[model samples]
Target: MGSNMLFVRDITPRKVNFSLRVKVMKIQIMNGKGYDSGKKTLELIVVDEQGDRIGVNIRHVLKPKFESALREHHHYILRNVVVVDNPVRFRSIHWNHETKLMFTHKSTIIPFESSQWTGPEGFNFLQFSDLKSPVLLKAGVTADVIGRVNSYGNIKQRGQTDDIPSKFINFELKDLSDVVVSCTLWGQFCIDFYNYMKKAGEDQCVIVLIQFGTTKDYIGELTVSSDWNFTSVLIDSDDVPAISDFRARLLELHANDNSVGSLAPMLTPPTNDLTKWFKDVKCVGLDDLRPDNPGIFVVHATIIAILPDEPWSYIACKKCNKKANTVDKNVDLTLNIDELLALERYCKKCGEKPKVQLRFKVSVRVEDDYGTASLTLFETQIQNYFDKSAYELQKSLPEDQDQPDELDELLGKSLLFKLEVSDFNRDRTYANYTVKDATTDSQFIQVFNEKYQTHKAGDDSYSFDVVKESSTSKVTSSTKGDSTSTTDGSQAVDLTADSDNSPLKKRIKTEPGTSPMSFSSSTNKPN
Candidate 1:
């Protein structure tokens, strides 16, 4: 027979500390086939602090077995699971009509719930050096951080595909104590917070709460998590705690703020001034400007060609629509049902037909004192700024015969007025400016190019060299001697061009026993 009459023993309870491992005994029920709903019977092993495993048989609900009786003994196994103090708890009671009894439910709540997290009482600021593990932080650890909101959007992924539905307003946070980091927010947060930020102007400082996690980015950069609630508060210099405060000292424990923007290289400076000048300047419609080298003056002008707004249709080959090299379409055409079936009816790259309707072109004009030019705007930039396509603009224009008279009058006239010069081109040949005011012909417009004119003096003269050479015969006589050897010297020639050639290339030559000769050409002389 199995062992019977097992004695029960009582043990003293011991207090458990953090990170201490302990074990408690638990009784489980095991039923056989058709016994209490066709369950299987089994034995389980319970392990203790030293990892010693003990096996015991499970008993039926009504059985006076070892497992069933041991269930009455309650024991403690572990202490607090998280390092932080347990969040505060609140209780709510509910009455159940069926049971006629009151039940209580407990909830965990944070005491200081603002739009953002606040540090401990008397906490001043957090610096990078104060963080024992700056890379990873436990929840509820509050520290002051300074960062800028990034204006860029967010990126998301659903299942395996990348879905960048929203962008972020990016910011770099730093504290006087040495804490510095970047923060980003997406979607509604961006629209709400970032829009306000842009209106608030750039380089504004704000405070934020951040959570750290490992994430795989497209570019492989490690990123941290931030939410609207975590990043909503704006903290100015005056709002920060004084440096002498305890919290301020904690902030100073971390690194300094000197290394902030050093993380990324500088990009090309913004061209806002140039853009503003174009918008202020007046001119005829952008059509008059050439597509190529719209001249040096308007090199920075934003230009674009309007495209068809509506989708186009095409008669595609049942097979490949690839055109035959030979002009004879009928002779070069090859028909095959299978090939035609496989051929794509539409161009996969662009959803429209290979051929489409004409669209209007648009451009922004740039000018200097000496001249003006137009630049084509890219389609994407146009869409971003105007929220319209080139095709849509083209379709809206009146036909050549019905062109507006106002447009004609505006042609060849200045669009921007009262621009202040800010910079000049590398060779000082061109100048850049910003528009401080605008003017119209009706308001007594004064064209800047006309206001400043350059002219050359009419009486300017330059010198040229001319060379002439001539050979001459001379006779000499000596007493009691026939004419001895006659001596002759060549004349010097001037270096100058002839009247028919450019004066710069003229040259004169001289030779012994020869007439002076001069040579000239149309080429300019080297200065």
Candidate 2:
């Protein structure tokens, strides 16, 4: 019998089976601060049934009456508050100067948290001791990760707390099966992870390997914290193991009490040949690939262009460099200014700004199988193939030589290229390769010429063809040179205009736009 039939039978009056409907109860609300055009206010509360509260200070909530009530009183509660899940956290706020009001609000909020939650049956939990140190996993390891995220305090300067600023991001590690502990990343890692989470949302799973951490408690629940000395974190995505299938195997191994050595290292099949695979493969936009693990991919491309090389310098005026001021002075006016100005205003090492030549770059509008993208090529790479250093080539050219010769060659030529793409996090990036080889293919030129001719001819159906043929005749021939064994047998045919009977008179005209004239005439009696 089907499960639905069983359910129907149980619900019927004739049946005596008993069932219960689950209802969630008990809510906790968090207190947070918010601001508007006129006043600072308190915002909505984030709560869980377990009596945990997370503060929410969204700007949109400030426009409603709830914000005013919460601000006047330290707290306010709605009797039958409609529970909305995954409210966006305000990441940034932008205001309009003219209107003197908030114009835009940016937040990191997801509508569903299911992608960030793990159930008992979801993943296989390995004990901390069983895992090896400095292990690596591929990007394809798992579909997603579910864990509790917490924010640690910012990093302050040692000598002056007001100067250099940094942030720390901490995550409490738990899965469907077991709870390990917590891990924290400082400085750049904190910034990178935060950006990745904000962009990837809750769907993408990030594989994190923890080193040297111990269990502890913050308030009442048991949590893990990393000691600064021994622990480190790395995101791995190489040779992604069979996580889903491994769950069953893991349980069997535990039942058998097997050691970690008994398991073999996971291996992945080799990647396909890029040139062969990508030739017919369709793309929409900007494609990104990374040789490294944890890569980013962006699709759909347009407005494809390249930026040529420009000169850069390492030095500037010391006084103006340190000070937050702009300095403008000619290279030759050092003497008069130095006498009148303070010694502190001494002329630093200054010269006429060296003119830098811009190299040829290529840009293309492309669409990947998914979306559109813009691809650009730098002058250095183009010069690399032409056997010329960018500096040497640019310096020797005249100011009037606006376009470099190398660039002219590549103006319409197609070539194979690769690109690396990254979002907010530099670590979580990828690379992609385009397989078109523009140099060898002449088909593009032919197509271009045909299109040009069609437009000029005003008839799209016009076509041109070349023909070759052979004609023969018999004739008596004689040579006036000495007959005694001529050493050189080579002879030259005279093609100049001749009034005598000549074979050239019978040749057909091949040039286009000429009148349709004939060469052969009525034959005279030859006998």
Candidate 3:
């Protein structure tokens, strides 16, 4: 295909010759460094028809002419190449001489028949646990690794650095031995991994191969990241036998692992900079929150009103945490009553009959001296705030009372809410603040008291002060409403003046400061 094109094994240093049917294994864009700083060069790895491999250096001036014609795993033909000695370090191929392909005046590249070439059978995959080997840690050395992705982190950029133009994806990968390591993919590798994940629609059971990756010690831990301009990532390919086998092992692990808690972190949204956000963040009043300054922030406020008219909970598919609608049993009328009844329990969200769980989802108005804002809490956060599970609370109603006593216990309590401020309105104020987490964590309370100079004993009108046992003071309602006492003797304040049939009006009798016994789903089912 080229004038006197020879096999890689036949090439000699200082002699000018071409190579034929060479399959490209790797290509890297090397920018200027040291003496060659500011110049852009191309380093190519190719294997000849005899399975012998060698590196090819394309000088900066010749890049515009030949860089685009070469692609990894593709066969190519070259002409008039000058052979030279291999680099002293980072030797990927066992060859004494490498090729230097210059502009057409000295060399040329041409497309060749790919079907006739036998490329690499698979990557020389290195185990994650063995990444710290002395031989693998040598400067300029690199290796390949294949593992299953276990977690995905947010994409982050370098701080005020112009030399690096791309962001990195922080991912957690686990090998067959179950050892886990944190990996970062930079630049195009990050973008390509995201695109592949998007196309796959789900990240589970994904096996990834990172080629020519280098390892480094980050904060006393062994970490692996892409080598500058060289590493390529392959994900979830049916043609790769190694990846296919990993998929089988992953399925087996999932089947044998009965603990659902191990999988929850993967389904939940990643907590963004938890320790940093907590340490540096100060709890502010509602009025002090600026919608223009969008980020995750903390707020301490007292619940002023609960919208009892709205849904207080949701039926969610256990697997995906999505709102689920019960399937219609009429479609399966041909089945017996028992079978048809079972069919009705299926969830539409996940397209399967997963065991459904009730999750608490409530909307309420919270207020401070400065302003009032709407707050919404989902199951996990609500459970944290009330210190009771939705199932437990739902089953706590007495035979004479319709509404559970837990709802009344939550009213008037001051809570620290971690809010995500996003989606500003036309007025420049945030349209909504999503409640990420709710807690009575002592650290939060300490921070709030230090900032506002308020005692832990609630004194403000909105605060729910624990009534002293000796004091004659009684609970007071901020809004004009009829109070329904629970069986525990705690007042259930109903602000819905128009709600004539509100079960919140039910009152249970008990001595003050006495808490009712916690109920579970097994105790009773709520209508």
Candidate 4:
């Protein structure tokens, strides 16, 4: 493509020496001479005139030789570079090559000069649908995804002492394909995203590109998350052609829709809808959880008691984060320390024996004014309520104490609970409601409630009317006319009838925060 330049796909092990003009996407400065048999090295990810990419390990001695060429998103020419096997388990990028390029004797890199042939930014982004691909879902397999921020959640930080606390937040990314992918950002990346949204003063049409992100199968659903130093985030990056094209396409698709730019107001709403429940997807009472209705519902409740003597934590496969089992097929729920360390655990999901970590699965009885129900809080949601993890809490206990004192704190604390309901939990009194998410923050709590129970009349909350939503239909408008349309990527009958249904937190401060699925016809944006 460029005089005498070989594309990344053309390189092979049969020919160890080659010349190529490539764009560098900086990888890590791998520590020590230790990894490569006493040769401390630097690895850079590079892309050719085509969007294809490969890992290039600068030989330890050659690391310094090429140190000055380590510019990200810059082009360069390599002469006489070598090839080696791609042996690492978690690859930097998702190229299917078995061998990687290397810097060897006589290898040299010079800055690429031709701007006319600059192919692309080298981002081979994963389709939103590809996030479910097992190959990409590997613990460290980097996945790149691009979409406009559909919705987001609060910035939740946790640390026993506040020194370098573990901070994380979740959001959704939606493509023009109408597919929505869940995203979670950790550490400083989470903080950076939070700051951007805080400044925007409200959630609006912000397009984001997550590069080198890791994917996880959270429960049964897939999620893409930032991988510490390996990942980079791009927000409304106008200079990048791909992003600009995507934004323009999004605008084109709904150009005349009139409801443009109404991304569920971030800083303030035009009205006093500070406590506006999104799309009028009202919050429900605990007693409102009926067997016929099954969808994720947010309820404000307090923990009444921790169901004791039940399993509070389980051994989780470190790689896949699923329940790990002993060879004989027993859940590692009650393994003693000696037995645990001596035995091997298997993860059916990964099909491999893996090291294990303790994870929380605490069941607590919670109560709203209407009634009390049992809920099973898992590791992700429980960690928000307790500074310490189940393992840490158990380790801190005295020999005679079976439960952690942290359970004492969860009691009486009113929280906004996002419960995922299916018909399987029809018997609300006995059914263990599995939590999708929970928040103790009052600001987020208010946004979660539909006026905090407008359904309540006297003490008989059950006496109030309940909206029977059909899977096939929903009412998107209040006018008495049959309407049909899609709502948040879902098929719905905007019936004059109520066949109904279901349904981001940047801080708008004192305002009801955003939800993972929210909508408004606001059409307002920050300048």
Residue 147 in model 4: lDDT: 90
Question: Ten consecutive residues with minimal summed lDDT in candidate 2?
Answer: 91-100
Candidates in order have lDDT scores of: 0.26, 0.28, 0.53, 0.60
Q: Model 4: per-residue lDDT, tens digit, 1-527?
A: 33356887787787754688888775566654445676656767677778777778776777776776567777788888777777652354455676788777678778865574567765778888776665555444567788987655565544311223367767778788878787888877777776676555343577788877877766555678887555677776777777789879988887877555553222211111122223334477777775457676777777777877555776677655567667875547465544664577677767998877776677677776567666766665556567886777767778776777787766775667766665554433225656655655443444444344454543323222322111111111110100111011122211121112311112222222322221111111111
Residue ranges of candidate 2 with Cα displaced over 4 Å: 1-45, 48-527
The residue pairs in collision within model 3 are 485-507, 485-508, 486-508, 487-508, 487-509
Q: What is the TM-score of each candidate against the true structure?
A: 0.28, 0.20, 0.41, 0.53
Q: What C-alpha RMSD separates each model from the true structure?
A: 31.8, 30.2, 20.1, 14.5
Residues 1-527 of candidate 3 have per-residue lDDT tens digits of 43565776676665554556677777777764544579977777666766566667777777787766777777777766665555542344233343433334567677867666665644656677665554444333456677876555444444312123456666767787878766778876766665554444232356777766666565445566776656666676646677678767766777666542232223111122223335444456666555566665677777767755545665556665555454562464344323432444555445787755656666676766556666656655445356666656655645554345676656777767777665442134533455765645333344445544442233332232221122111111111111110111112233222212322211111221111111111111111
Weakest 10 consecutive residues, lDDT, candidate 3? Answer: 478-487
Q: Report the number of the highest-TM-score candidate.
A: 4
Which should have the higher lDDT, number 1 or number 4?
4
Off by over 4 Å in 1: 1-166, 178-180, 199-205, 210-375, 383-396, 399-527
For candidate 4, the lDDT comes to: 0.60
- lDDT agreement of model 1 with the native: 0.26
lDDT of 4 at 453: 47
Better of 1 and 2 by lDDT: 2
Sort all candidates by lDDT, best to worst: 4, 3, 2, 1
Candidate 4 Cα deviation (angstroms), residue 474: 22
What TM-score should be assigned to candidate 2? 0.20
Query: What does candidate 2's lDDT look like per residue over 86-158, in tens digits?
Result: 2232111111001101112321222223333222211222343322122321111111222323111222112
